[model samples]
Target: MDKIEFLTEKAAQIRRDLLKMIVNAGTGHTAGSLSNTDIMTVLFYEVMDIKVDDPDWDDRDRFILSKGHSVESYYTILADKGYFDKEELNTFCQYKSRLIGHPNNKVPGVEMNTGALGHGLAIAAGMAKAAKMSKKNYKVYTLMGDGELAEGSVWEAALAASHFKLDNLVGIIDRNNLQITDNTEKVMGLEPLAEKWKSFGWEIIEVDGHNYQELINAFTKSSEIKGRPTLILANTIKGKGVSFMENKAEWHHGLPSEEELAQALEELSSKGEVI
Candidate 1:
């Protein structure tokens, strides 16, 4: 298959895998995870330069899941990429399992422990700055939830990234509009979000988060930008691919029942051409 087709099918399967993993674990950030699956897929499978067998190779590009609660998709991608045994996903969130509710550094491919929100940007910026200092060409990518933008630290990090001219740093916002309790705007407004980032000296690129082609192009474009960090404002649908759960805030951290799981699988499978 071609690149776009390959990415689409890969993302579909990832969604399925994360769903099963979450249901088996009996807990997860469902909506956000689903929402960001496509973005994660593009980065891991195509955009980023990574080594599955040597996850910590010095020159490998870095990925930081700042919105760590939505780690189902992230973990699924890592397992699929051979960073760990895929079977380990079945133990997610279990007592003593390395795969807990959020991104954990103990995991083979995880760059840093995150989930506190607003801290990922700073950490990623530091990595980018370090790369520049060491004269390494590797890039640093960070994914953040739109809701997380409310934290003042995110802006502070944005300012730092710009001031240092960390062109190697790429920040992506999962602009799904919903958080755990309500709409992102209701919880905290982020309108003109692109302008805010621009004012902080970031080059903003907005795209359909679920569209493979747009995502690929945006990531590619980020690499070509110079003297400033890039921010990809990815507009996405929370609980995407599952009809009943789409855009519903309740599913932000909901565990699917067996029947719901079955229905979701059927829906995903119904897209015969994709998965």
Candidate 2:
């Protein structure tokens, strides 16, 4: 099989793994996790330079999930990449389990305790700036939800990323229009979003979040940009894989019934195999 096909299959497996983890745990941010599956899959499997056995290795690429509630897929990808045992997924959300509703440093591959939203970009910019100060080549990547863009801190970090000229930092906004309470535009308008970032002195790249090719091309281009940070505005469906869940805001914190889980599994399966 070709590289795209392999990545596609791996993404499907990631979706299945996260779904089962959420369904079994009886709670999760399903829609956002599903939406960012393809993006996260590409980063972990293709783009990021990471070592599963040596997660803390110097010079490794760093990734922060600013929208940390969508962490089901994040944890699953970490375990699948062998940062931690896959069996730990079964204990997710249980009392005293490290895999709580949001991501924390307790997990092997997680960089910071996130979930409050809008803080990831600031932290990532700090890391990237430190890399420049220490003369290191590692790049820092952070993923944020579009709804989180309303946070004042996000723009402050954006300004800092540009002012410092941290070319090694890449920030991605998951442009899924729906948030927990309402549509993103309804809650807060972010149109001319790309222009806003460009005005802040960052290079802007727009892409279909689910298209592996577009995502790959965007990351490649980010590396070539100099004297500025890169911002990838990834347009995405809130619940991409499942028909019933697609674009529906109600699923933001919704739990699936066993029947719903079975249906979703079938939809995500390939050749009758989820994994």
Clashing pairs in 1: none
Tens-digit lDDT track of model 2 for 160-227: 99999999999999999999999999999999899999999999999999999999999999999999
Could you tell me which 10 consecutive residues in candidate 1 have the lowest summed lDDT? 266-275
Model 2: residue 81 alpha-carbon error in angstroms: 0.4
lDDT of 1 by residue, 185-211 (tens): 888899888898999999999999999
In candidate 2 the C-alpha lDDT for residue 203 amounts to: 97
User: Which residue pairs does candidate 2 place in steric collision?
Assistant: none
Query: Model 1: what TM-score?
Result: 0.98
TM-score, model 2 to reference:
0.98
Every model's TM-score: 0.98, 0.98
Off by over 4 Å in 1: 272-275
Error of 2 at 267 (Å): 0.6
